[model samples]
Target chain A: MNPEQLNSPNDFQTIVNKIYQNEQFDFVGIALQSSEAPHSIKWDFVAGNTNERFRKIVLRSGIGIAGLVVRTGKPFWDNNLNHYEFSDEMYTPIAKTESLRSAVAIPIISPLTNLVRGVLLAGYRSNKIKISGQTALTLSQYL
Target chain B: MLETTRWINNYFNDSTDAIMIFKDDELILSNQIAKDLQNELELNPQYLVEVADSSVKQKFSPTDNCFSCIIQNKMKEISIPITLAKNMPHPLNYFMIYNVIDQNEKVFSLTLKNRGTIDRMDQLAQQRKLTQYVNRAHEKERKRISEDLHDSIAQGVYSAIMGVRRLENNHFTAEEIKELTTVIESQLNDTLTEVKEMALDIRPSVLDNFGLLAALKVLAKRLEENSGVTINVAGNANTEHLSDDIQSVLYRITQESINNALKHANADEITVLLVAHNHYITLEIMDDGDGFDVPKYQHFNGKSMGLMNMNERVKTFNGAFKMESKSGEGTTITVKFPVA
Candidate 1:
């Protein structure tokens, strides 16, 4: 997983596409820290067609979607993301990138101290789609 | 001409007050009261009617009535003092009308005057009560901080210092030296444990850094160590995500209850149950400690600050707090605070 080898925009997309191709999810993406990737945190990895709007977002700790998981060191799951209020302004980059409607994020913690380092965001454009606990665990196993 | 006569007649007939109507400088109608009031002022009924008629015909403004009217805003329903020529028979009480306004602005202020007196008294009383409450809150915070420092960091330092002294003073037989080293190591371990427990108790960095569940585990450990009591805590709350105030109040109440049980109850076991139901958080603390007669204790205590403090904290958030205890029976304290 040297990102340099996957320098093309579709490189990260290839990983998410492989997962969704075998699974039932609508979209899957990897949100790495800007400090780690140095280019784009929004479309760092995309498995679907996303707009230029995805690359416009920069998140601070404890703020937007991925930032909350990173800062709190907790995984967030919303089976019904539509029921949850979305401050879309904070997630405009993500929203535009995948045209996402419902979403969930899990923080990948360090193996030793269990500190949060990055996030894996999975979402769908359909209102009826939900990310269940089983699905989240399954996604975590892969991502 | 015919329409003017009808209008004048209608004006006098429709009003209860003394009415006079005119149009195009002609006196068309005058009510009996108007004629009488006019005559009492040594004004010929006909002549006074003519003057009033002409004033209305000219569309005289409110300023024109200033001489006879007390209230300036004509639009206001008010009591206006008019010179009635000493011959008018109606009482002065009839002069006022309720709910009147002067072109939407109140010309006559009907407010209760001298409200300043009562308001000042109320403000003083409020200030005094607020000051008293603030003082009590400050005192509680100070006590919590002091107890935390004494029980945690201070005790830790004392243990560590003793350990270091034993290590430095190395003039003893090999057997005695072996014992001394063991004592030093024990002291060091105890100090470290104390530091961590005290830090957790004073402010469970877990509650702040983590959440209520982590903090509760810390509190349970502290209570067990200090009281020689076993506290069984159960239930899973996504407490890390709960609001700060709820977490604080629950923690404080739990801490206080455990303290009371340890100090007053000769109980060997305590249990804390937390359940989330119906968008509310309920906490139950039960102890198999010696219970006192509820009524007798209430009368004897006469508002213990500890109990009062808990009640006050609970009430501030519009929560419910209850204590159930009977002599020869164990005690149970329950608190429920809404989250959603």
Candidate 2:
């Protein structure tokens, strides 16, 4: 499915597949917030995942990669993850399960209200991947 | 106040130190501690602004503030001295202030922490942590001793009692009765030996009567016989010039090390060297067994707390302790103390 065809939750997987096929990423995922009180975020669509454990990851705002992007409405990524503590509870819920050493996440904002509604993540399994602002800008173009 | 930020106000208001919040030069909220300071210094709300040093003022301003970016800067800051209208009970009035000013939210807070109060709080926190570690180590020891009594000593004695009762109720030949009596006698003897070993564990009387060398040698011989391992103890720590406390500490450290080697290391041979020169004593224990990661177990580990407990004991007696270990290699512990 193309970006213009993202009318249903099932279509989100095609967008993830589109990004994964067009990029040099090992994994591509989309996480969206629920429209309710105590709005939590979950991985709605993913491509090239090693396992289905990402479906079990539910994060609050300002927590993991997706949650942080939704909370701060800023692009987030770790260029060098050599010293990143995998056992830290803050990021381990997704990073450990997916074995992701580095990732870049960008917010998807609703143009009308200027509020972040979802996040798009492109990541690699190797720690040596150096994701920069140019890389985040490249990923944001897909959103 | 915005409903979203009401919780921050409530949280800061419950602090034990002086905290005052400002919104566009208007005093919005003040905690009880801040009210007390205002009364004692005869100060107005403006004091929070003027009391801050120029060095701190350069940090950030409330309007168009980006202070949150640098909020976690290093501490070790100089105290802000205050000249007050009224005299305080302290010899000098000084504060170490922590400020959080948010221009976007249009609310800023300044918390004036008394230098003396901060020092007292740091000392109390350290004492609390130390008390908890010591209590945990103490409780672990008590559990081990209880397990020994219940599993080995109590069970042995119970079985011997049952054997004696069976001998009374059975109709047997005189020869069989003699053999049974002998068996019961040996069982009681073994229980007696276990009781003696436990008493020795508590505090060996040899340590008081014959001094450190005799105590360590006797301990080594008994452990060698029980564990079927060779333990070599060669030390001339001549206990004459030492006080009773120093002697006991040395004995306890050595005992604990050997026990660790036998139980955890699975070592076949161990060596202990204790030497006392003119003004200092050095003790070293080495074992040929599997060693573990030192830094990993140096923290609050219940099963392997012997290292930290021994280190604490040595430090209490004004001694230096050093430990070296490597996986598949062996463990070595050295302790040194200055003598008078």
Candidate 3:
């Protein structure tokens, strides 16, 4: 994939949708931090959002799962979100809003600055779908 | 004898304390004060035995033998602790004195006085002191914010304005003007950052938008970054159903607890847990730090407003607050609020 293509919102949504379709995940989305407001992160594109709540949320850095990824600049994944003790409070709102059970979040780091600029999250509502850290790293290559 | 009888009646009626006369285990006469006390205490006049059984039965036994002892002039006075009602402000110290009227009827006069009124008054006074401490905390916070604005943003903007006015001068070269503009722009950016920090300190917008859990996560992250203490937040509580007022209260409480742990407790790790149940919500913050003697700071002495503020905030929502700690051991603060 060309680096320039990722700059366009339309192309970004198309790529996210394609990843959701190719991986057969229940949900896939992207949360990008606004350049003007560095503290704000919004779910710019969501492939399987049940409601508009995800779009309305302006996640602060170090807040939700996406915020955690952005703050640490690291990939985060949970095989079963419910079983993850530390992420219980972190994932409830996002999981309930999107009907997700297991999820993975990978920070999209800028090549030049090596700082996290956005997050790519993929998950499933079905309990059988287990997301592993290896799968998150594999998907992160697409970014 | 009629004049003396009238005088005795007036004395009994004018007594401040409740006075009841009993003869042979039956209430024979009660003064106006006694009637008022019965109504105020919500005691049943018909079940005098049950009343005595509930109040004086445990301590003095108000039984037939005791009454006989008093009538026989063996016991001069008997005092027993009596609670008029459950959850009353205080208990009363009931006193019974042996007396004879006209040498025809043997009688016992009962009087009730509140034993814990002084304690209750002391509690009210302490509460007033706590309220004043809370006010001082608010006042200090306001002063800090004002000073931050005046010292940083106000000065930055004043310099920027002076720079713009200087740019109007024709004596300055193009390069000099460009450099001055860059300096002014940087100053403006710094001022904006300072204002944002002040706004966040007052009330983080994320708390209102994303609820308590999100706000707490942000707080934990900030505290960890600043203090180098690792904070792990666990448990899932759906705070979307709660009112904004409740969310704000819980967020502020957690914020204060974390701050106290960072500043006072020399701990390397802190854990915060939030859980929601059928009827209530629970929040626990524990730190592996050197703990202080809890009893020393439990009173309203105006030195430790952090704990007091957290306690008052929890109480405002009718919540239960508890703190457990020991010297050299860790401290844990727990708060529980009923879901409304």
Question: Which candidate gets the maximum TM-score versus the true structure?
Answer: 3
lDDT of 3 at B212: 81
List clashing residue pairs in candidate 2.
Answer: none
Fnat by candidate, in order:
0.00, 0.00, 0.00
Write one digit per residue (lDDT tens) for candidate 2, span A1-143: 24445458766777688889998888888887655433446678889887665675654444456556765679898744334332221443455446677888899765433446678888888856688898899987776
Count: clashes, candidate 2: 0
lDDT of 1 at A2: 46
Those runs of model 1 whose alpha carbons end farther than 4 Å from true positions after fitting are A1-143, B1-178, B293-303
lDDT of 3 by residue, B109-220 (tens): 5665556664678789988887787788789788877876776667768866876887776466675565555545654664675577667778988877887888788778
Q: Write the per-residue lDDT of candidate 2 for residues B173-266, one digit (tens) a residue.
A: 7766654555455445546666777788878989888988888898887766444457899987787788888788888888888877866675
Interface RMSD of candidate 1, in Å, is: 24.2
Candidate 2 Cα errors over 4 Å, as ranges: A1-143, B1-98, B102-126, B129-182, B301-304
Interface RMSD of each: 24.2, 31.5, 12.3
**What tier of docking accuracy does candidate 2 attain?**
incorrect
Q: Would you give the TM-score of chain B in model 1?
A: 0.53
Separate DockQ for every predicted complex: 0.01, 0.01, 0.02
lDDT of 3 at B334: 96
